[model samples]
Target: MSTVTVTARGVTPDDVRAVARGTARVVVDDDARDAMATSRAIVDRIEADGRPVYGVSTGFGALANTQIAPERRSELQHALIRSHAAGVGAPMPREVVRAMLLLRVRSLALGRSGVRPEVAQSLVDLLNADITPWVPEHGSLGASGDLAPLAHCALVLMGEGWVRSPSGSRTDGGQALAAAGLKPLALAAKEGLALINGTDGMLGMLLLALHDAAHLFTMADVTTALAIEAMLGSDRPFQPELHAIRPHPGQALAAANVHRLLQGSAVMDSHRDDALHAVQDAYSMRCAAQVAGAARDTRDFAAQIAERELRAVVDNPVVLPDGRVESTGNFHGAPLGFAADFLAIAAAEVGAIAERRVDRLLDVTRSRGLPPFLSPDAGVNSGLMIAQYTAAGIVAENRRLASPASVDSLPTSGMQEDHVSMGWAAAVKLRRVLDNLTSILAVELLAGVRGLQLRAPLVPSPAGQAAIAAVGGTPGPDVYLAPAMEHARAVVTSPELRTQIENAVGPLS
Candidate 1:
């Protein structure tokens, strides 16, 4: 049980992933607590002075003009959480909900959102207890800081919403808290607004997607190298000299990875100087590094945006050092929306190109003398023929998902929140695209490894041999294609396989 300290400086993408996917504990640092106290003094001053500050003494969006009496202010905060917990769909994954809790704690711990230190600690308590609030998948428009999703989380803190207990059973929020030896929080002035007003949901999903994409992208490069050797294609196109002249950073890195992976390969050496054997390979084989490189660039660009968002204070009516509370539009999620949408397009392109390589590996004419479908018995076994179809179907779906959700906006809150960001939608779609890309690469690995085995005496490179050993499914008269395909997919997604490959051949880009 490792612990991640949340400070005013904020946490990293890795920190988010740890708390989200692993059993890591969270702690708010002392400096962040002190800062929260300093900010709380300002909020208290506003309340005592009887000034109508937005979110502090007044109403929320589309209702900001209506002022509430001091006696009714606590009720106002309670009403906000109850009204906004309006999400309706299947409950979100536990990891995603855990991430939202960690991120909201980070936002409040930053000290910009005027909240008592206890408010932030309550979220940490929920996380430490492994109590996940039941957040529906379809509430946030990704504007006003993923309001609906965060509201569901806030409701749990107040012991008034549904939650999944540590034992994985659905239970009332109050019972869950009591079972974990924790107490529910009482909302104060501006506390409810502070709890829900942040881009934690979409941002959490983006970070997780980026984490998975990093592994998948490297696997893509590895599979492309295997495909080249399996197809008896020329590796000349991956020369550093060729990539250096054009000098796209990602292009250079991708080319170098493939070049390194193909070192000391008997298959590539067999037809090195035979001009008639392969004067030119097809676009999928020849331009693999180029397509994967472009996707790498896109992933890096999205990472930059995510890093900046991680350090942001994404709430309205932020407390300033000058003892003033100013309302700002920092809650809008446009930046996160664009980044998720861009990454979706990149993932789709990578998967689409890999699908093409899978098709080539199965075709007798294009596979350079390999048997049709790589079947051990030509007519008796269909081999991995249907696997290619599965890959193609997923690629088609990914193309549709790549359509930018950020570009489509439906106004809400009586048009007070005109032009919502829809970042949550974009992030959700990106997750699907990444999953499809992983499956697509698995199909290629299955075909490519079979092709390598078909070449017999002409062995693949060291890294390629490691990949073959990792996905040890012998090419023969097909025996239950579904299980073999699943095994290949599991190998494709495993970190152990990537570690094995990198150990054999240095490190991939």
Candidate 2:
């Protein structure tokens, strides 16, 4: 693994990706000490003047007007963390939790949020030392900036939540803090608000979703080519002229990618006019350029939003360089929340469309001369008949989860959080959509590869055949349908196949 010093201003999306993949580590920059000092002095000025700050000297949410005596302010901060640590659901994946830590660390390092140097360093120490909190997957509104989820993050700094050590699970934060030899941070000034009030959940979810979408967009194109050839469809629709007229970047790219994948192949070239007898291929094939293109466009747009959110200071009562502070809605999740919903919609469509193509591959009427249900002895052996059913089941679930959570908001926090973007729901559903798309595409990959093999000696383009060869040569004719589905799911989800294909063809742009 490589180590990278992460000053708030210097972190990039690539840096976050490296952290997510576990190929890199993060540390506060040497200059951050000065930033921390600036933060501390700012807090002093706020204290000297006795300013009323949101989530600082006052209470939170509906209780924002409630004041705490200075003597109890420190206790107030700790109590806030402990009280808001109310996440409930299955624990988030280790990668997601780690990404949250990284986001919090980056936000603090920006030096815009009014958190003390100790608070920022504690975040750094927790991440660098791997003292991550086991946060739950749900319980966030994506407004007031993922309050509950982030509070648990702050709790880990206080040494009270569940954490994993080399040995086993430990609920005692003190023991884990001592074992790691890390000290608890004194939440000076606006530290609690700085800790909990941010869009880290939405940010983390957006980054991971966008990253996966970019990879999967490439996979979708390649998989579609396999499906096209397997179905004996015409390649004319992929001609550059159609995409050139409309000139959508993602559409043109999809068309170009399909053409490249189909280059130098007997299956495609020999059957160049093969579908002349039919009016046009189904939407799955005919509209592949458009559907896949839309998804690609959305993914790119979402990536932009993720980059912006990652660099931003998302805390309330933002601390300035001179210790003057201001309350603001920087904690609102509207920005990334919208993108999260968009991402879920696109990903669900990706799966929804792939499911249609898989249906075409399995259907008795539409599947060319192949055996019904993809089995030679259709009556005796079910073959992939039920696999298609399972794919349908998954696609249905994706559709159900695809509803835009950002559009629907319910008030909480005594209506103070009215119009809360359910962006958290969007994140959760996008995750499900990603998983469903992988499975849906996997089933199609299996069926398409089988569809390709059944055509024997009529192999696809060099790129296509090479991909086939790389997927462990071709399986035997009697291979069980279950394993093929499993294999296809693995290939689509694994970055290896996607990366290899891109390497073979070079950059799209």
Best by lDDT: 1
What does the lDDT come to for candidate 2?
Answer: 0.77
Please write out the lDDT profile of model 1 over residues 20-68, one tens digit for every residue: 9999999999999999989998999999999989998899999998899
Residue-level lDDT tens digits of model 2 in 27-60: 7886765676677677777767787777768888
Please report the TM-score between candidate 2 and the true structure: 0.94
* Leading candidate by TM-score: 1
Find the 10 residues in a row with the least total lDDT in model 1. 164-173
Give each prediction's root-mean-square deviation over alpha carbons.
1.1, 2.2
Q: Which parts of model 1 have CA positions greater than 4 angstroms off?
A: 165-169
